[model samples]
Target chain A: MKKKNICITLMFSLVLGLCACSQESDSDRPERSETEVRKEEVFGEGEKIKLRGVYLNGDEVQNDIMDNYIKKNWTERFPDVEIEWEGTGDLTNLLKTYSATGDLPDIWYSDAASATAIINAGNQLNLADHITEDHFIDHYVNPEALYYSDGGIYAVSSGIDAFYTPAIYYNKKIFEQYELTEPETYDELIQVCQTLIDDGITPISIVGTTGWSVRNFLFFTILMNDDPKAAQALLSNEIDFSDERVVNALKKIEDMLNMGCFPEGVANIDFSTHMALYAEGKTAMIATMSWGYPELETAQDTGVFMWPSSNPQVKTGQVLQIWGSSLNGWAVNSRSENRDLAVQVAEYCTEQEAFRHAAQGSSLNFKTENPAEVTSELEKERMAIYNNAEQYIKTLHLNAMDSAVAAEFATYTNLLLAGDYTAEQFVKDFNPIWKENTWFEK
Target chain B: MNKFYTKKGKLLFALPGLLLFSVFVIYPMIPQILISFQSHNGAEALGYVGWNNYTNLFQSNVFGKVHRNTYFIVGCSLLIALPVSLLLALLLERASAGVRTVFKFGALFPSVLSVTVIGKMWAGIYDADWGMLNSILRGIGMEQLTRSWLTNADTVVPCIAAAFLWQYIGLNCILFYAGIKAIPEQYYEAAIIDGAGFWRASICITIPLLQDIIKYVVIISTLGSMGMYAHILVMTAGGPGDASRSVLYQMYYKAFSMSQFGEGCAIAVIFIIECIIVSIIINKCIAKEPIQY
Candidate 1:
């Protein structure tokens, strides 16, 4: 009887303790909407408001030069609005979890592919509501780039990103050792791969596990046939998946696979391993995006070129570009208690990043003061590719599609690299998947 | 004290555990069931879409493959893990103290290590260019046998199952060892007097008496294999076209990766049913009558 009384007393105390722990302290609660002011007016005066943020590249926030630069500069500009940032390598999965729980961070870094899902979940704030005058959207090199599908500016751009065209970054020393020049066309590239293979070297390595790299190779090949029309048809779902051009593109990739272009077990090779293969001189070439620039720069004697075209009519200068509408940037949580302050933090982060990128002479969709001069040889060459390009075509299939469609695209592409499907089977299998997921009207 | 012995007071003792179970498990399951029948985008239910998610799951090209892979993994755990663990336990029972200690530590080491570390270690072994498996094949003059293990559909599921089995085999063996230690020595001595060797003793005495322990381990192993996600995530990520994907991995991909929460929940419902059915079967078949000393 004494033990039973003790047990009841302990259980009640445990429940009470849980309840006590859950109650918010007086200090933890936000300052609330006491001060409704204009964009220029500072928020939370004499009080600190800490906003939690999760970014795609937030995992390395401490080591990130750009984030640190933004943090130091923003601290001086908005001293009261403190942001407690957390980084994640897998932002999409993180956001999905948060959105389900109705506990999204104050700010999150999102790209075009992921923005639709967040907005559909009603997690994104329409920046237009908060900033009526001097809106950041108006300053964009292309304002439409930041607009949500429903015609509201949901995200603010940090900088104008270059169209993500997967380029072949090669080991210059290896090329020189074999006396090989950069290949100019499909057949030439194949012949170059053959030479490398015969010399007992893998010609290329890709982030095959992710699926996007192989998809880039396929889409770029299709764009080679007729850049703009093919991109538009695919994006708008006007062209069927089993179209001759599409099937032909898949065959070209298959031919490369047959020609011993990629590393053994390419489908399991991740981004870091793929990069390491080139850096370590195990593979002669790597096909990846401009994001590979930093890693490639670190490697000695690395050179870059666009994936060579297959069609006779496709010119040397034609290249794929991510349009302004699909640029990645900062988004404020619509459901946040500190929505007003969150919007301010997001805007400050965006403008600050854009300014820094501008100062660095990187791509900018918006105008800024005193753009830095490009001095590095590699930077000069990259700029030359952009300048010399006949047209900047948007590859909508990869970038501008609904998030689900993009995910399926990656899955199917991974399957293709795995030898699970022939080119014909791939298209037949993917056609229904594409149709099922796509939101765009024909 | 006498008043506390009443039925109402006795039921109060179970209240806390019941409350916790209701709040954590039973409460969430109600909404999950509802969501499985609705069109959800992770955040909230959009509308009723009865049977759509289930129909889609059945219709999906990768669905059949994931199910088959899941069953294959469970089968491996049952067929390979059970017999091998029992054999090892029997061997350990007869071994000297030092050998027993070494064997025990060796068995539990993989179980205690992080799943990520084990998954990654296995991935490295199966890597195509520089992996230990391919290197061994090459060294042994069987270069033709050196194919990418994780990426190939034929070998991918089996490779993952091998890793999963390798992780839990030792722990299961330890459980069997404990059971063996509990069995009466007189039975074994009586068998020895009847000219029974180690094999016959094990077959007749150890196997029959260890039914209860075997049943428990079999159920746990089967259910654990069915619900596995992390190893697949770290190794192949349900890739090479979802050829190596399990039911849990597919649910994760559908819900988190693609934000098809409705479909994911439907998978969860089916998974729960599958687990319950499997547990019932294991209970019925393994130890119909509870064994007593």
Candidate 2:
């Protein structure tokens, strides 16, 4: 009887242990249905391809439009091709790393002028055969903008848009309360700001912490009051920043700050806070880019006008140089296995149809003309600016110079806004870096 | 024959762990040390520049500011957090079992959250216009004091260190609490009988016994405070003119953002050396003989 009881206890314990082992194994196994398995198998059949892209945070070009459209269209168009998209921040560094690793993406998007480093590194694909003159003319409003060294088409340009100046976005409710007319000139704008301040309202909500927004106020004014060619020449090392135009512009911004046009703690205010101040009618005006319209439109009773220039002669003629490029396009990666399929997808996205779709979705696409569905008055004003391309000057940072120089410019601008450096000092700091990194000799 | 077999078995058992430690820790450190001497571009060696990278770093604004900021933050964290944690640990040790468990669990809760989440939450709390702290201050009619906490150079590091204390105090508390709990009941009973009051007993018995654990905690926390990157990155991005930039943060920015791998590696080497020197000095100062109960 004692032996039988011991045997039973041992047998029970063994059975329990086996049950526990089976339970653990079952938990470890990944649960998938037969249909899910089949779907994954079908999806896996295509020749796998990945494309790496670098994009800006506020652009909404890649994530909102291109990625979504490609994912939808690629599988239908090419059943055997699988395209994977890897997006990266900080385009300048990303491209440099890629060049270092020799792991350039199969297809990538980069600014044409700023791509000199990659081109110098011998990593860029020569798309001369892929792009033709007729294609260029049809796609780009100004084909000359796409020109690069070696007289070969390394990349294609997209449709051109007019440059955007730093615009004054005012709260309409505040303006109506003060019975203020839209200021047309720099002096008038200053007077109106003073009036608003006298009426117990903060004159301008400057998000100086953003650095770029503060820079826009400084850069646009300088470009407007100064000779364009001279300013460009100075930036390109043809002249010096110590010139009167640059100095006067810097002085004007400092003068404006001293005049109580900006808030007490303007330098500490971030973009969101500035916008909130405008929305709540605490401030009369805020300076920002054309791209900011989409976000600022969410504010109550918002209105925008071009920033007034100090030079009376050129005030009307001067517009904020569209600080970046219009040549946003897709490229097929040289290392891609499904190069043909990737090119097809790229072409499809850049075509007129995709532009129309993008326009309908409240995004500005390069190829498409004005879409009728863009009912917002602000967008209508933006579309007019886009149509009148000759009225604006294109400041080429994204497409005109090396990206490292632009990043340095951004840093200097930040220092200037932080009151750590003067305009002359800013220029002096960048001159050597530009000489070292760029093709410019001096 | 049995002794020889046991010795062989022990060696065989220890081999795998030793191999892993060498591969993961000892071997990788060799490359890190070597990379410090050569110039690089994020990955590959650009060229050899012995001490040039380090020399340039000394001349740069980022290095001096980061060094000062790291030491300041570590100092603040140690000065404020260590005593608070010890006090909490002592108080909990004197409580009932149920109360002790509750307080211990409460203290450990902050450690459960990731650093990124804590940073973001504090950012909201410290926001100039819409932050909870500012709102409370305004309600109390201290609106003049409402300023951008993270952007102001004078306040940013201390603000970040305060957040660090909140996140880490609980951990230290739990550790010291465990150490205190591990002390035998007889020691405390003898002290009480010898007319030792609570404070006297703690200073004489509890603190001395917990010295090793305290030393370890201080060293680790100091290193952690020096190497703080993610909180600053996610919250302020070492912004408002590099007010909160740490050495590690600067190294990461150079390597990942600017693609100056040579400078970054150089910064890393210097940072490691600083940490080592600091740890050694602390160990020497705080080293104590183990007490026999």
Candidate 3:
């Protein structure tokens, strides 16, 4: 019996050993054909199609808009296709896992990196062919952002949330009490923080542990001096991350940390508390993008300022601006049996009718040239910021760099925030990650 | 012929489960090993690049720190949880029926609670300001002892281990309690009659008799420590500059976050080997031969 058990175990082990010599081929990555991508619009007008879509769950508004507002409109246009929406955690990891395992959900929402990885894997449908010049994609408020131009389009998004861009949402009442003017220079911003600090108040409520929150402060420095064009270049080694521009950005954030602008144990405070601290008037300011809206809304006297012109890319009036929004879009899985139908589904989901409804109850600025009609005064203020900017730069750096590098950026930045690394040491420590990166889309 | 037919009938009943075990469990092991050697980019398989993934895994800057963290958590389980669990079981074994019932309820409380709830609860407890832990420390005027428990690199892993131990110690206690109960009461009664004290009876008789369960618990604890990812993920998100990450968290980070699937699988393989080795060592140390009652 013992011998038999040993033999049984040995047999499984041997099988495992043999199977270890793998014959698995590259998944769906055949060599590209010489022809330009087939762009024929394959409209699904018949009963044989089941369109599968992966959507962000818990956004009941977006969900209602998709299920009722958009679905009814879409089916009226193309009657026979059955729409099945799959909801998942709003996680990029979920999409990435599906892509990795050759189980790309038929239609999935994707961020730039997720789409880029899929595109680079040669698994996404070429969207450019089917999307006409007259398509809703052309009307995106920021058409430049509708698709990443890698010689072809691969994804389509409903709209962009321009309001999510980083700004210091300050308590106007507190500023009035303290007689603090909105800062127009990095030094002045520090002075603002210092004046607030001297009055026995936390100068800023920033969530350090939640993510690389310092990146926004640093980006202000970068956008102030340089055009936001080198994100890809820096990753591809065309421009070094150790450049003076990059180092200066790092110093800008480091300076804030050194000045004790953020609260003690800032690294431990989560985003909710960070926002709450500001909402409750415990902090003088919050360095946040529009995602802090609900929190920003509660503080009835909150005023906003762009991170005081760090280096000013343009004259102060025409400073380059960004509205941080979801880098998500709809893409068709190339391996899907219903690839053609999936493309139609992507279009149906992101088209004008859908974009209009999805943008409803959302303060996000869309890429459409035909803007969603703004009813809220707050949205108009957001749009005025969007309108006044010379350049609407997207913060794609997080998605542009290797995920590992981005994570390390956050890690090292947290170290600076946590007092483990001084500004110079932060720069010194950053050089290694910059030197050894493997994931670059360029 | 009838016996053989009956045996075959038993095999037929187990076939579906056996097939599932083969396909879902045994089969995935081979590919998991195979994928470790391949250059999988999470985007697609980039073809085989034998040992390249392992080399990259070794090259990861955080690998050593993560390795140390994993082992430290395992050590915490061994040194702290095991002893506490055994102690609880011993106390429960000797307690009166009502006291035993109360102890059982207390012992199993954390076990039934979700790890997510436990992790989040402990996270709030360990919060630097207004947390139960810091508040108590402040209330006692040991304010210097209070710090951001989850944010400090020195304290993050230990704090997580404490929470993890909170869940696991109870579980192991229940396991040990059951094992102690299974020890025929006659042996304890006879030992007492011979003037053996409780400690002597426990040390000389009860403990030896519980070796079978001890072996099982040790193996489970070792494997549990090896694969512990969720609690740390929920509590820390592997932060304080990734200082609190275990090997499993790193594996997930590498594959999903960095798209380094092959390297992640390599970590998985190395983790599997570590688990197997630990299990073997524990089995050897705990019970070579079963002690018949």
Best by DockQ: 3
Tens digits of per-residue lDDT, candidate 2, A203-268, equal 887676535565544564455545566556654556545567766666566667667777654555
Give lDDT: candidate 2, residue A246.
62
Error of 3 at A259 (Å): 2.7
Chain A, candidate 2, TM-score of 0.75
How far out, in Å, is residue B135 in model 1?
A: 2.0
lDDT of 1 by residue, A327-422 (tens): 367888876767777777777777777676666667677667787876556666766776778766655554545656666777888888887478
Residue lDDT tens for model 3, A1-442 = 5455445655765576456544435565443221113122243333335567787664555566566656668768756656677777645777777776666778877665566667778777777766763364554565555555456666676555444566677888999999998887767888988998898989988887735566544444344534455543453467665677666666766667778898766776666678888988889888776546555766657777666655455443244435432446678777666666677677767764345544554533234344457655554565567567675555544434566666677777666666656667876777787666654445
State candidate 1's TM-score.
0.89
In candidate 1, stretches whose alpha carbon ends up further than 4 angstroms from where it belongs are A1-47, A58-67, A70-75, A129-132, A135-139, A216-218, A323-327, A355-361, A366-376, B1-10, B183-196
lDDT of 1: 0.77
Residue-wise lDDT of candidate 3 within B157-202, one digit each (tens)?
9999899988989889989999998888899889989999978998
Per-model i-RMS in Å?
5.1, 13.3, 4.7
Candidate 2 i-RMS: 13.3
Report lDDT (Cα) of residue A373, candidate 1. Answer: 78
For model 3, state the Cα shift of residue A273 in Å: 3.2
Q: Report clash pairs, candidate 2.
A: A106-A333, A107-A333
